[model samples]
Target: MSSHAPPARTHLLIASLCLLGLLSTTGASLPYPILAPLFAGDVGNGLSAFLGLPPKLLLGIALMVNPLGLLIGSAVLGAVSDRLGRRRILLATAIGAAAGHALTAAALVAESYPLFLLARFVTGLLEGNGAIMRAMVVERVEGPLRNHALSWLNGAFHLGWLVGPLLAGFTVGVSITLPFTIAAGALLVGALLAASALERGTAAAKAGERWWRVARERHAFTLLRHAPLRTLFSVHFAYACGVAAFYEFFPLWLVDVGGYAVREIAFVNMGMCALMTGAALFAGRASSTEPRRRASIQAGLAALSILAVGFGSLGVGLAAIVLFGLPHAYYNATVQGWAADQFAGYGQGAVMGLLSTTFCLANIVMALAGGALALVDTRIVLVLGGALALWAALAMRNWSRRAVSVAAQAVELR
Candidate 1:
């Protein structure tokens, strides 16, 4: 019997998931690049003083909730996707994210710090969209397309970050509430579209199995035993912790230390977005035929960028932000693709969920550390972040060698 080719709609399905992933990330990150200014002023300050706290501490209180929610969401909802099907969980996530954003808008109007933080945390609990989208794309697409799809998804993530903060900056003075409202609307539409457009569970092996049972399966831990898998998890953990810590402190450094305006800050972020998007696009093009070399290049770029951040020369900070964002896009795509390759035959959703949970936990630890460190010294945070990135680079070096050998043998077999 001749093998049946995948349906033509596969590409369209993958692309739609990418767009949804973009929306999910943008909605989650919309607050980050502008949190200091948005919540540090008159209204926010009143709330801070009433709550008996410093402005940055108040911000940290709000910010800490997001990663905590993400950590929980990735672990719980991710497993939900494994049993409930990708479409159901993604749609539910969209609804949850939209509701969270709406709450943010309401909180902005009310100027309530506690409510605002609650909204952000609830929104964050819906962060499984990215992992679900990745699992969907890699599962549906084959060969080079799978690698390309992941790279493009990573690129889309940067695009969301690019759009979210820039748009938030434009609206901050006009109305901080406005950005939240807009984000809410966008997510609502995305959720609706995903529900109608995406397929669900046609080929699921244990469709009738309870979610908890599937969640406890041995395969999840089995995948972790693989060396490459462990390396990817390490890289995600270190890089996320470092980046979260640096970003937590970066804006304060710029305002209190650098004396830059909101627009200037936004422009600096744009530089990171540009480099990140560019690298992701470049890496995706190379993922299929040369997964190993691509991994090495990503690791090299990451290490260089981290070094640049720590060099501590005049104007180096500005240069470092751009450099730091450059390598992450590719590194994320390559590692995620590597994970997909490991579970090439079965249970993609479960594996993706397990990996995402690790990513979220790393962010949670990093955010907590970031909050604590900012109380001490922001400069120390940057230095520590750079060191972690360097460590991730070394780990990636080992993964690259293994990837290269795998790619070579696969090619030779052909």
Candidate 2:
């Protein structure tokens, strides 16, 4: 690992970026454990019961707005990075998003739903630096070492998912807004790290079109119009929908159905994310039809988890939740790597942006759908998620084949 990488600058950049991933993601996910407790911990909190809406419905809206901002940001931010320079944009976003978190905490203190949602939206918009991180890796790291660097980077993100909720669960007892405040500080530290450790380098303008023009002409949604990418996007969307359902409602599942408290739910997430972190470290290794295989494995596990959580006891639910991390890591890594490898011609930033938007879009869709279903039963929401995952995983080959055939027909017609 040490020998293949560039001597000092590259080494520090990767190290800082990895640390930034962990710290920033910790800040990002800190709200996870808090949301369930604050929104649904009891029958309803002031915010959750705001406007006399159902707790789940209110939670759904809270969940939806952040990813909505992400969908918008991922679509547009790549172009901004291209024009502004990735490091500059990243450092600015990291700091800006930290302030956004502080605003979010203020909204919570004020019990203002509108402000809270707006804060979440703006925070997500700034946090849309995933593409920037990927661009940095590709630009700075050369050869196979890039993959290794990416694995480490991804592992840091996974670790953040574990640590964030864990910290929130333990500390939320001090004050409801405490976790968010801590999260804000974590992100500030990460911003400082990025500013100090990273080099201030400008990207070479690759194409004639400036980033602003590119932003207007080609962005995340436009990827859907590309025939070859349609198949890829479809599969990724389905997979993302499944994960989104599981992520958004599982805590509600534990809190309402399983009689678990926020800390308990956090423990469940910690176990799952821990497994995810471990799996990610090795997920970059060999696998046959890796993208398909990974998705299929995840779909199967997801289906099994649905049964375990819905029918089995609380213990079963806990088990299912924790176990999901294994396949999730493999599935995410393979699909992302596959997209990068297969569609680099589309522009690496664009491909990565597509993946981010798809994930964000799925989260938005599932939050609304799951919120509605949770009114009837949370279990039902989990089942629908499983169905989507299954369809994407089991029918992948046939769907892709059919898509290719359709593309061929359209070409002939033209």
Candidate 3:
């Protein structure tokens, strides 16, 4: 008999994790649709204007706070899971995240800005369960099976992005916080699913060490001490910057250039996300090795640059928006698989965490950079995104040469 369990068991495990991804991300995204309206100086003045800051500025801070928390959490939580068992940490975080959402609901009801920010930060922190999920997929499912599992997981996440805002939009009319409470309940369901799928034993490494000591010493950021990882981080960060720019500003491009409104923009996003989800289902079958994956990423970045530039005009923009999802799906799944394979010695948890942290940092940096550029021209910001993508591709090509050189040197030494 093969050492692996039955294929059916693997399928069930993947299915459970996908459901977990879908549910947790649904909860994570629930607050997004509501945030714009809340801080636009209309529904909740007391919360928005607490420090007498401009509502727009307050909105920016509110948005930044969650991802900032997520950046820290993603770097820390995954490393924690490497020491602790996956299920226990994930389960605790899920329950804690539900409480965070509840706290957000309470803050909304109370109209307290400080409380609201606190709730959002904590919620984002717990939402770092994403790193845990990715690590679990990479660790449990081996060989080609890993790719299929991750594709479905990524697909489930994309579907959640589509599902969450719609759910929030529907419930916001009833009460501002109703969607958040619903989100909490959804997360609990996800926790149950994760519990069913995950293995129970803790890692034996540094077995008696303090949790904080482990987290402090072995988190994803610690990976940067190595020269190769620094190169990997640079390429990933640059590519992520391009992605973040497009993600943050493309809607603005539609608004400013194409004269689209909220509902129309939402429709475009719906189509894009739907395509992304579908593409993710097929991304694993793309016939990829590390070199091919790198080439595909470069190609995808170049294509994204073109799409970004062409996306300002209404007719082409609509097509560009929807078409972006296909390559995006392939890019995400493949990069993840590549990272897991390349850095398994670092611990899959920490590797996955580093990727999430990189993305979140890119989002933050791009949002700030794009916001400034948008003031000049939305089209200009979109073009900048494309330029960054091209730069990232160039960087990737250059890095591959150095990687080959290093390999040749190692062979000579041996």
TM-score for all models, in order of appearance: 0.82, 0.81, 0.92
Q: Over 4 Å off in model 1, which ranges?
A: 1-8, 33-38, 44-56, 110-114, 172-174, 203-228, 250-258, 287-293, 370-379, 399-414
* Per-model lDDT: 0.70, 0.76, 0.80
lDDT head-to-head 2 vs 3, winner: 3
Tell me the tens digit of each residue's lDDT in model 2 across 93-115. 88888888899989989988889
Could you arrange the candidates by lDDT from highest to lowest? 3, 2, 1
lDDT minimum window of 10 residues, candidate 1:
1-10
Better model by TM-score: candidate 1 vs candidate 3: 3
- Output the number of the TM-score-best candidate: 3
**Clashing residue pairs, backbone N/CA/C < 3 A, model 3:** none
Query: Residue 33 lDDT in model 2?
Result: 57
Worst 10 residues of 3 by lDDT: 1-10
Candidate 1 displacement at residue 197 in angstroms? 3.0
- lDDT, candidate 1, 244-353, per-residue tens: 65665676566656788877877887888888888777666542445544655665566555555545553877787777776777777776787678665545765676
Minimum summed lDDT over a 10-residue window in model 2 is located at 1-10
